[model samples]
Every structure is written in C-alpha cells, then in structure tokens.
Target: MNQNTKIYGLVLAGGHSRRMGTDKGLLHYHNKPQREFLYEQLQNICDAVFMSIRPEQQAELPRGFRHIVDENMYRGPLNGLLSAHHSFPEAAWLVVACDLPLVNEKILKYLLERRNKKAMATAFATRKTGLPEPLAAIWEPQGLRQAEIYMKTAASSCPRKFLLNVETTLVHPEDDLWVANANEPEEQQRLLAKLNII
Candidate 1:
C-alpha cells in the first residue's frame, strides 16, 4: 500500500434490512451490535474507523463513533462505499457489511496483511463461488473512482459486477465461513446457530 494513502475502516450499516424484518446492524451475534463489533474490529487494525449510515439512521446510533452519512447517489452497497470514498478520497477503505455475523477481527487482519496496493482493490473471494466479495474488501481510491464511472452506466450498479471486471486482487480465505452473510431472518438464525449464539 502507498504510504501516502492511509487505510481507513468503514462499517457498512446503512441497509434498510427489509428482508431481515429489522435492522441487521443491531443484531447481536457476538454480544454486541454487529456493526459495532465490526467497527471495533476495524479500529484495532486501521488508522481510523467510521460507520457508513443512512441519514435517518444517525439518531438511533450510539455516540462516540465516527460516521459518514450516505450520499444516496447510488443504490446498494455502492452508496455506502462511494459515500465513504467521497468523505476520505485519499484513504483506502477496508469495508465490511453489518449483515456478516461470522466475520471477525482475525479475518480483517488477514485481509489487511494481503492487501495489494497496486491492484484497484484487494478483495476476499471464496473458492466455491470464485467471485469477488466487494463489501468485504479494501477499495483503493483509483478503483473507487472507476466504480463511480461504472455506476454511471444504466446496466451496472452492483459493486460485485464492477469488481469482477476491474483490476482487483482476490485473496481466498482458509474457509468461506468468515465471509458468510446473514441477510434474511433464516440466514441469521443459521449463522447464530453456527456461532452457538442461538
């Protein structure tokens, strides 16, 4: 990574969680809100940490943590990712979604250790899917700039689609469990059971 560009941590907690039937960020799989757990994990590794949130979500947030409000310029995770990029254009954002209940501090440290600054972004990809997990990656400023361009196209708004065609470095974890997402209620329950939380 370039010395000029510091790595910052971003917790993606702006989703509506319509399918989960409640706020996913508030889920307590590890005795703390999932987003707070991620923020604290990132704080342990990155130069700084901030939570990406929707404008209305701010009031419900606990104090002391830094946050970047969504610009709402794009849909999906791109909105939070791009919003963080806009807030700190010079920093590389190590982003993690709030819906991921199994991701822990160790996995985040692993990602940082293997980051390729030369690549557009250094992302986690699973062997089973062979696809880049954009939300669980370090997005370089240049790559994020390209993502902004990619979003301009009417056909492509998804971050995974953008990363698939870009110069992102994919690092595979020992197992895919660390990157598992708990989007729907059932998925959350399954992950909770896996973690012995439920």
Candidate 2:
C-alpha cells in the first residue's frame, strides 16, 4: 500500500560529543555545519522536519526548523526518537544522526522506497554487518509505542534493546556512501577529502 504517509524527519543532535570535545552537529564541512547539511538533505523527503537537541544546547540550535527538546533525559538517541514518536504518533519517523556526512538523498530515497507499513520499522543494513546502524532508520508510530513500553519496563533508554523487540525491516547497503560519518577529526578529514570539499 502506498501510504503516502507523512514521515517526520528527526535529526538526532543530543549527543554529548565527549570524544570529539566539540559538538559534532555544529562542526563545519564544506563551509556548512554538518547538521545544517543533513537537515537540508532530509528536508527533500520529509513532510516536516525537526532537530532533537539537548536542553542546555537549545540556544545553539539553527533557526527555521522546529526543535524538540529531549524531555525524558536519557543519554541515548532513543530518547530523541521517543520524543518525536510521542509528538507525532500518527506518522512514521525518519531518524537520522547529525554527524553522518554520507547520508545522501539517494540512500534516503532507497530506504523510503522499501518502507512497509506492516513492519515496526525499516533500516539500512550492509550484508557484512548486522542491524548495527540504528542511526539511520525509519520508525513507525506503533514501533514508537513499543519502544516506549519497553523503555518504561526496562527503565533504560537503549535503542538497540528496543529494536530487538520490534519487527524491523532491513535493506542491503548497496550504497556504501550512506555509511560515511564524522566521528573524529580524522574521519572528518576523510569525509572532506572524499567529497573534494577541501
């Protein structure tokens, strides 16, 4: 069924960035903050978009896009996902991390094309790796409810554990470019070189 569902685009920007010693989302690549580029790309497909930010960093958020503060106070991306799911329970949520440099339009389109309403969620998977990249996934409204229930019982907000219980659909990572991310300085440099932006 072509649901034509209005999937909400959620950019996970609540990470502490302890490893990098800087906000990963605010770092620059190609003269634009990484998060802005991601939001720009995501806007192409999402019916509406919002950035998930930590409460303390709310002032640092870019203008124009709506912001959803993580009210649950968990230290993982699941908190942001749950917040969005709760806010828009009637629609699927396209959750993406802000630091991923390679999540281009092509891969996003491919993932969206494979979405099944019957499944709890859908995500990309490389044949070599299992369901490891939770950063790039689609969460149905029902999946969010399942996650919320699991989280309430588990008393923890781990996305992996939540995913274990849901009916998640998977897609082959035929497009390796979507896996590119800037986790550290070296990785950022590599992304710049790969994109020929530096």
Candidate 3:
C-alpha cells in the first residue's frame, strides 16, 4: 500500500444477475447485502469507495455510499470498470465483484501490499487456470487508458482476455476461496454450505 498512490475501491454491482435469478449483490450471506458487505470492507482499505450501478438501480443503492452509474450501453463488468475509470481517471481502482462472497480483509490487504505499481495492472491468477482475475485486481490509470483504447475495437470486451494480453502482475491468491464467485443457484448453495449458512 503506497501511501502516495491514491487507490479507490470500486464495487461492481451492476450485473443483471440473469443466471442467479436474483440480484446477487443484494443476496444475504454475511447477515447483510453482499454489496454492502464488500463496500464496508473496501471502505476500511481504500481512500474512498464507490458502487458501480446502473441508472435504474440507483434508487435501491444504500444511502451515504458514493456511486457511479454506467454511462455507456456496454454490458458486463467492463462497463463498471470503464465507467469508474472515466469518472476518476487519476486514482487507481481496486475493483471487486459483488458476487465474491468469500472476499475478506486479509485478501484485500495482501493484494494491496503486493501491488506492482509499474505493471499495467496487478491481479490474482486463478488457481485453476493461472489466468489473471481482473475483477479481483487493481487497475492503474495507465492500464485503464489502455483498456479504453482497447474497448474501441471489438477484441477487448472480456476483461480476463484483456488481462491475458496485457502486462499484468499476477499473484496466486492465498486462498482460492477468496476469489470464488457464485453466479447460479447451485453455486450459491455450494458457497452457502462452505460458509455454513445452510
């Protein structure tokens, strides 16, 4: 955690949750909405934190937390990341998805502590494939700029793919569970069982 670098947290909660059959961010896994939980956690480590949401979801956002609504028509997490980058192009974004129920302070601390300032981005490598996990990563200003340019072409929508072709510092997560995200009911149930919620 460089004291001079302004790192802002971006909680991605704009997804339509088509696979989950409900808003995954609004789901309760830790006695509070997962979005809220992640927001609180980010608040502790970031200079400031904002929720990435759609304009329609603004009304449902909890009060007192800052947010940036999608301005472009693009779908998926790229929209949230780029929206936040456009809003605050100077600060590096510590991006996290709302569906990651197992994300914790320790994991966040580890990521920040090991952030490679010189790399285009600092991300965790998936335990399964060793590919960069863009959502659980830090996107520097330069990286975001590159991403903006990439977005102009049809080849750069998928974040993981973008990471794969970029200069990213990939670290193995201390615990793979920290990066696990639940996108379906069955996955959510499995996570719930792991958390002893069932």
Candidate 4:
C-alpha cells in the first residue's frame, strides 16, 4: 500500500432487497450478516470503511459502525458512490457491494497496486464481463466530481453510464471465484456450501 495514497472503503448496502425479501446486507450467509463480513474484510485493506444506505432504512441497519445516506434520493448504485464521494472527498474509495461476499483483501490490494493518476480508474474486466464491476471499482476523489456531474445531467441513474465516460484500467477475470456475488438465497447457499460452511 502506498503511504501517499489514502484510500477509503465503501460498502453499498442500499438495495431495496425486494428480490431477497429482506435487507440483503443483514442476511446471514456464514453465521454473520453479509455486510459485517464485508466490513470486517474491508477493514483489512482500507483506511476507513462505511456502509451506504437509504435514510428511511437506517433504523433497521446494524450498529457499531457508521453509515452514509443517499440524500439526493437518486436511484441506483450511483447514489451510494456519490454519497461516499461527498463524505470523504480526500480519499479514493473502493466501492464494494455487500452481496459480494467473495471479495477479499488480495483483490483489493491488487486494485490498489494498479492505481495510477486520479483520472484513471482501476477495475476488473472479464472477457465475459467487460469493464470493472462498477460496484466493485476504485473511485478517486476527483472521479467522484465527474460522476456527480454525470448523474445530475443523465436521464438514467446508471453507474456504468458514468464509468464509461472515465478513463479506466481493466483487470481481466482470472477466476470465477473473484466475481461471485450472492444475489438470491440459492446463490448465497451455494457460496456457503462451496466454502464448506454449510
């Protein structure tokens, strides 16, 4: 880790979870809330970490750590990214989604190693999945400003739309293990079963 490069960690936990039928971040996958697992893991790789959620759902969220609300009321993952950018304008944030239980310190360190100019974003790019996963990408403080402008002007609130406009470095997907995101209960069960935790 570069001492000069200060990076924060952001856990995107704002999803409505209509599909999961509950707060996805709070669901237990391995005897722990998914968000707590992510938060603990991110703590190993970042200077600071915070959960991004909606203001109305704040009460149902777990305590012990702080959270950032998307006051803009803007929809999509972009709202979480923008909120993190506004809260910590000085540090580059590694924006991760809570559903990605497979994310680890090694992957985060890999991204940090490739971080170059503020204009460049380091992301994972699989031949199967082009561009870094937006929710799993590294965002520089300056990049946050650019994303804000895009969100304000775009008719759609897609994070990918904002990322496409920026300069980025891509890491090809080497293993399927790195990109596993538990979107549904069955997927969550499979991940835990694969890990031999269930």
Can you give the TM-score per candidate against the true fold?
0.97, 0.89, 0.95, 0.87
lDDT of each: 0.91, 0.78, 0.88, 0.76
Candidate 2: lDDT over CA atoms?
A: 0.78
Best by TM-score: 1
> What tens digits encode model 2's per-residue C-alpha lDDT throughout 7-99?
988888888887777899888764787777777778989898888887897777766868788887445788888777777778888888977
Please, what are the lDDT tens digits per residue for candidate 1 over residues 1-198? Answer: 466789999999999999999999998998989999999999889999999999998998899989999999998889999999998888999999998888889999999999998889999999899899999999998998888988888496788988889898998989998899898988988888999866
Worst 10 residues of 4 by lDDT: 116-125
Please list the residue runs of candidate 2 whose C-alpha ends up more than 4 Å from where it truly belongs after superposition: 1-4
lDDT of 3 by residue, 69-155 (tens): 998655568899999988888889999998888887778888999998878899988688798999999999889888878878855
Backbone clash pairs for candidate 1 read none
Measured over all alpha carbons after superposition, the RMSD of each candidate to the real structure, in angstroms, is 1.1, 2.2, 1.8, 2.6
Better of 1 and 3 by lDDT: 1
Better of 2 and 4 by TM-score: 2
- Model 4: runs farther than 4 Å from truth? 1-5
Best by lDDT: 1
lDDT of 2 at 192: 74
For model 1, how big is the CA root-mean-square deviation? Answer: 1.1
